[model samples]
Target: MPPTRVGAMRRRGLFVSGAIQRMRHGPAPGRWILLIGVSLVLGVALRWCGLPAGFLLGPMIAAIALSVAGGAVAVPRVPFQLSQAVIGCLIARTITLPILTEIGAQWPVFLGGVFSVIAVSLIIGWLLTKWQVLPGPTAIWGVSPGAAVAMTLMSSAYGADARLVAFMQYTRVVIVASAASILAAVLAPSADGGGAGSWWPSSVAGRGGTLLVVAVGFVVARLLRTPAGPLLAAIVIAALAQDLLGLKLELPLPLLAVSFAFVGWGIGMRFTRSTLSHAVRALPAVIASILILVLVCGGIAVLLVVFAGVAPLTAYLATSPGGADTVAIIASSTHVDVAYIMAMQLARFFAVMLTGPFLARMLTRWSGYHAADRA
Candidate 1:
């Protein structure tokens, strides 16, 4: 046991400990760092390309490509979709009763004082089952054309398939939104603004209000656990408030559109790649459900022209059963009765959300359907 032997043992022990530590930690543990770097580079590239006005249709197509290329992400269902109803109804300050009340006045002029349009919706809804087009409740919700999120919630509650309902609605949105410009271009009378609608809640919030609302919305959205819905709601609401006051915010359109894209990405990521893959196989059924909806709602619009004495074009946009933002924009640009269109649309949205679930439960004949998960 000499000093030289003791030094040799100590050196061996040090080597052993170092080797074990290296084994535990491994190399390149910062995977997310690399992902962030790549995402950042992509973002900058996108911003710099200078996409032409109303050129978002291309970018959206690109995003879909990226999501598919990135591969399917599998995980438990996320929580935020459930919160969309709450976020839609309450997060935005502009969804006030005053605006809604004013919008309601047009229902008489459009739906008839006897609620003929809604009655039509109900009858059309029943026929969907007759045609084997959709689950009864979902058909009703699909044809409803109200608030998409609200309808989703109602379907969830009444025991319809929330995911299917959401997927169907989202599909229709993509279809209408994707084709909006094309349709407008084809259908627009040259003298009538060429079917290019004005941005609704036309007042853009100035720098100060925009920043303030963005900050407040970010904080509240984080706190409320409504990741995307609240933030988007903030943009919509604050801008709306500014418009109502006649001092609109003047933020650049590109910035707002980008914000919307990010929000959409977050929501799109919720259903793991697998959920969407399954949805892909079921695309025919999903597409069928939405087609039925478009037909029924479109028919309702045509009938309103006859029964309520509203113009066919005006009622067509009003009853188009598309997204609130999309329809709102159409109404504003076309100089349609924005108030009435929004009122009926919003009510339908809420109706779909709150009541869709129970109605789904009432349909007991479906083979794979359920009452609780509602999806």
Candidate 2:
């Protein structure tokens, strides 16, 4: 009775399906252009607003939105690895002989503070798992108070959901950075006078050397096949070169922006609807854990004030569970002892980077054992 109508309907359905498929996979150039444009706009806006890691966060947010809306575009592996290496080099540039000496002078204080943060992170991770908020070691890595990018990449390497880890890491970074900035304003309003330097490098030689180090680091990481090997290798090599050989490592603004975009896109494009939903649901617990950490670290800061005789702001900045880069900015903008805060932050960074993987594994196992016992 309706053969022609049915045939026409079938062809229309096929046409719609083909169009959807083409949109997702065939329009590569258009998708890239759109994604890059959106990323740039957001990145610039956020940077202008003075948010921490604004470039990275902007691209991340853009990618997440596009991904959830079915316009996802993937970042290639080589670019992502290069991005990680670049970030590693950036971290390395901050590790100078003076920072090392400072840490060495107060080894006990550094040790206690760094371990206290790590232990609290472990406890939070364990509780997340016990509460069944995230699966396995993902919770452990998510709550680790390390360099956010480092934690996210390392967690992905260890088979945790990088998307979720990135969510947790960046969320805490934003919160902690904001809190530190507020505290800085409240404590020393007169000291907030520092501005960022020029984005271009002063020396071409330094930039070349930095690139060479990153290339070597990439190769070494490939050889080692370790989790986040590229990043770790770059950090070690660049730090050695900078501190021991007195080489200046420079990461220009443009280069850093592209690298940050690659990393942000890499994490953002991996999100599926399911992961996004999980992240949304787990966000409350994540925020709660972060607040608890901040409070506990504040208590630690008070101890530093009383016993170590450090300035309150310096102590707080040093102990704040945010990214080292963000903390450095806050320290610089305020009248706090920038070197001391950085030293403390770097000490904690190294400690977390060295022990994070082992702790994640141990906690995962421990959590699993408890789950089995309950069963």
Candidate 3:
């Protein structure tokens, strides 16, 4: 096969692997419906049982992680991972200049988190490659502060092994989120530390409408092929629209829980038997590469917090190199600066998108693999 064709074939496997995973792990079609229905029921029960606010994503993430660990369900496949690319693309429509200005205006808080994580991800990638734990391209992309899904997709697009990318991306996020949540619980500044944290709008329905708007905006953004930056942007715009229109957005708590459950289900679908069995033959290196990246990026976040003397907790929350939106949600429950987290997350995202391919090329040259091998 031509090198390009080889690349394409590997790229195609990203989706194929996921389907095969489902076939092996998932129930028959009739059972799948029953499982999904049960999931919805459980999600609703959890939401109604007085889970803390802004924690809908937590349950879903837990479901995905638990399923993978306990073997209750198949690991998600590449197609499901690819589906998030569409979500990212559609979410691009959320951007507006006002939203940029909103976050950019908080320059000091934003820049601290952004540069800190970038420096960390870069240094970590270099170290893993030096240690021979990972191929350079895999290490570079693995440590990036961008969206987990985005990193995986870009890696696939560049002809990196789809299974490795998916595993590393999801694993990093799982570690980062779990660790951050625990740390924040133990060490977060008392809720009353500052002026009682600013009051969030009480209108749940209005908020849900904003989410609807964001979802709609994403569709348009994807159709336009706009970059993914706007997913948060669209949320901001919708928030603005809600305020301007004085529309009180009321979100049903149970409904919110189900929404995130779907997202988790989708995320879980990224891995399967193939992803673990054949695909993970090379995972020892990949896992080592990721652990090193975490330590490095995490250290940067700690340093940034100390240097900035910002609320170490808030700065730390904002600085961790996880997904923009996911991090923002975590910060919300912990009462960190939601805008700051969102901003820093976006900065890291653009950083990964712009640099992932170049990193892939550099690693290929250094590691004895042809760049063309990265499909």
Candidate 2: misplaced stretches above 4 Å?
A: 1-26, 129-141, 147-199, 279-283, 309-375
Q: Write one digit per residue (lDDT tens) for candidate 3, span 329-354.
A: 34544545555555567776776677
Give the candidates in order of lDDT, highest first.
2, 3, 1
TM-score, model 2 to reference: 0.71
Top model by TM-score, which number?
Answer: 2
Clashes of 3: 28
- Poorest 10 consecutive residues by lDDT, candidate 1: 82-91
Quote the lDDT for 98 in model 2: 80
My TM-score estimates for the predictions, one after another, are 0.57, 0.71, 0.67
Model 3 CA lDDT for position 143 = 68
Estimate, for each residue in 1-375, the C-alpha lDDT of model 1 and write its tens digit: 999999999999999767534532333333223323334454445334322112233333433433444432221223223222222222233444565665466545544422433455455555564454555456555554445555666565554556666666666665655444344334432222212322343444444565556555555666665323453555455646654764334334344344333333333333344435646655776666556656666677777788777666556666666665555433433434555565566555545455545544443344334344233
- Candidate 3 vs. true structure, TM-score: 0.67
How displaced is residue 30 in candidate 1, in Å?
16
Q: Which has the better lDDT: candidate 2, or candidate 3? A: 2
Reference-based lDDT, each prediction: 0.48, 0.75, 0.54
Find the 10 residues in a row with the least total lDDT in model 3.
189-198
Give the lDDT of residue 361 in candidate 2: 78
